[model samples]
Target: VGHTIESTVLALESIAATDNIAKNLGIEAGETIYYVKRIRYIDGKILCLEESYYRQSIVPYLNREIVEQSIFEYLETALQLNIGFSDMYMHVGKLSAESARHLGLTEGDPGLTIETVFHLTNGRPFDYSVITYHYEHSQFVVQANGLYL
Candidate 1:
């Protein structure tokens, strides 16, 4: 038996980059970039809100149909980009009013926020994203391999 997982793309647009986003993506402020917002559900229950920004110079094109499928697959198979690694941060936070509404919770409800910056094999940052997970439904597992003293 397994739980069903689903994702809905809420917004997908091209917009001028902000300073912070520009810095994260190694692009200039006001450069065109693709922004995508989506929500993930498990077992028919909303679980997380995800927002991502991609460099237009690298990604070039995107559409609702493509985004609803898999951006990673397009980047790898079509663009031939090598996804190398990411830097991530996680923290406890209160959901914003918009996030709460999408998650079926009240504003200020507890949530887990994860921020990540993804890089290419050449160490160029191409995507930055933030994901907010519903506190009641979120679970995380980490596996470590190392020598313990």
Candidate 2:
């Protein structure tokens, strides 16, 4: 599980870096800059979330639009690893509270338990489902269901 989580993080970082470089080369909106804040692993899977930010002082020479898009494409492809939104949201929520107060979420926030499953189509929000899992004397313990919040 640790390896899986690390792989996901590295993949995301690589995509973001690639986009940044492409932007410097005038590629366009193929990539967007994001700061990874958290990663969580459970039941042989990993989840992560990142926040996007802009740096005006460090402008790239490439086409920002193309570079941003390219980055998005890269992430979307990597997500094919079968990662889920529930894990991402929970981990990110915790991370935001711990390391990104600017994100406006706090630890033990009830909202984290709600909205367990999220669906995406073409990188857009589609719908969501609730799920729960528990690991007893095992390596994972996660449990939730629809609309707890």
Best by lDDT: 1
Model 2 lDDT, full chain set: 0.31
Candidate lDDT scores, in order, read 0.91, 0.31
Which ten-residue region of model 1 has the weakest summed lDDT?
Answer: 140-149
The estimated TM-scores of all candidates read 0.90, 0.19
Give per-residue CA lDDT, model 1, range 1-149, as digits (tens): 39787779999999999999998999999999999999988888887899999998889999998887678998999999999999998988888899899888999989889999999999999999999998888788876788676
Clashing pairs in 1: none
After superposing candidate 1, which stretches have Cα over 4 Å from the reference? 1-3, 145-149
> Per-residue CA lDDT of candidate 2, range 1-149, in tens?
34432212311222333554333323334444332323333334432222232221222222333233333344346434223343233321233254223223344432232223222332322122221111121244557776676
Count of clashes, each model: 0, 29
Model 1: lDDT equals 0.91
